[model samples]
Target: MLIKECKGFELEKEKSNTSEDFFNRSEVTFIENGEEKTLHVLYVRYFDEILQEFTPYSQDPILADQGLDVTFKDIVALVCLLKNPGLRGRKRLYINSKHDFAAYFQDIDFSKLPEVFQSLKQKNSYELRSPLEFILQPK
Candidate 1:
């Protein structure tokens, strides 16, 4: 499926130049179950102490054969934010089925990302109220 629109946000106001940890906050809209649904996605790159390298991560589970064809084990990381009626002015952010607010590294094909994401390095945050095409599947 193709993401019809994508908008990004930066969680942190102050960035540390020395720190290698960074993450992308984006809202992706796609057609699901014959209706349009928007998913909040977070693609993170963090410094791994044990590996001594920057690792990619997401705080949510990538369900296989559901939204995308990829399996959970095939990913580097994922996070999904959903609305919770009980929480006031707060959304539930899931790091996967097992953990909440926890993060782990996952591998994602950088080539498949949209140009908006590719240009993220130049600007830390951006909000574009326009239509954009982002393909998750490899062409």
Candidate 2:
């Protein structure tokens, strides 16, 4: 769906890229079940200045289709987890797409973490890592 139809997220411009055509960007947002939401997200690339015609220019509209992609910083930690799990911070892959949510149910046992979507604010006993723990937690 077009961002204009969605309820969350704002259009922004990238100031660092001095080039006129490439300066537009937006802080990534996600849509779940046709609605927008997030939880404890610390996305930092949002533009302070709004780009009048840029259309959330950081990511092309297609990204909104595949859902939010794994970020650079997130990728770094993911790879590190494979090499060394001891140093990585408490990581959670919050589900922001339909595919992720479906994939979650297909791969995991219902008894381990039973909620279809659990917000981060709710404290739970599943914080312990299993070499690498990935949850389909939601916003």
Candidate 3:
């Protein structure tokens, strides 16, 4: 379904805040089947310890200098892979599920994703946003 068509959703307060008060917000909407669902699309703050557990090999200067942090978008992509066991890769970012993608990012327009990003089939082993298409849909 097109994101523009999905409307009239509200954010649930209890699940809105994360560890760092980053406000992990999402829109709760009722699907055509009358099933209520949530579309969490926000950034999650990560500390050094959490980064160490996920990406011990991260040599990014920003991560080392800032004590390592990741956005909620990063976590969502990771969860997508974890939720789907049949997907194969060396732990990288890529689009695997249309349903999850739509549910998580209702504001993005996937049709305009760049060819390069959309073609990215490999997933990153670390916790990070997938290709541009997976995060921002070229607005």
Candidate 4:
């Protein structure tokens, strides 16, 4: 019954986090209610515009679920990125699976995304390396 805003949350991607035990053991620090708290955010959800709802691919979002990885920031970003043309149009970016690319695309610059994705276009059944793959990939 409590909803609060996260002031900001930044992951230092360049540095490998030894604490990250894959997704199951990852955690992030964020600001909420004027105080800092670390939450275990791990669930994946996609925005369903047709149904006008949020579809959770994981367990239900409840405080009792200590292992749940879902977070408001992640859900918001996924919805925002899916709304952009860069991730959806002709110069589309194909994610082999959710594990390949998740909600991180929303944090990147949308204006430059379309251009970067152009390099990813496949040729003769072999996909080319994209500058975006390095950029958008989650650490």
Give candidates' CA RMSD values in order: 12.5, 15.0, 14.4, 18.4
Candidate number of the best lDDT: 1
C-alpha lDDT of all candidate models, in order: 0.32, 0.27, 0.30, 0.30
- Summed over model 4, clashes come to 4
Tens-digit lDDT track of model 4 for 1-139: 0112211123333457553222221232333345543333332223212112223233322112333333333333223333342432122232323533444433443343223223222211112133343234466
Question: Arrange candidates by lDDT, highest first: which order?
Answer: 1, 3, 4, 2
Among residues 3 or more apart in sequence or in different chains, the pairs in candidate 3 whose N, CA or C atoms overlap within 3 Å are: 43-72, 44-72, 91-124, 91-125, 92-123, 92-124, 93-123, 93-124
lDDT of 1 by residue, 19-138 (tens): 223543555454434565555545443311222222232322222222333322222221122122122123223232222223222222333333333333234322322222211335
Model 3, span 1-139: residue lDDT tens: 1111111112245554533353233221212233333343333333222333333234322122222333323334323332332222233333334444434344333333322122221221122233333444343
Give the winner by TM-score. Answer: 1
User: What TM-score would you give candidate 2 relative to the actual structure?
Assistant: 0.21
Better of 2 and 4 by lDDT: 4
* Selected candidate, larger TM-score, 1 vs 3: 1
TM-score of each model, in listed order:
0.32, 0.21, 0.23, 0.20
Looking at model 3, residue 108 earns an lDDT score of 37
Give the Å error, residue 35, model 3: 15
Per-candidate clash tally: 11, 1, 8, 4
Tell me the deviation in Å of residue 35 in model 4: 2.5
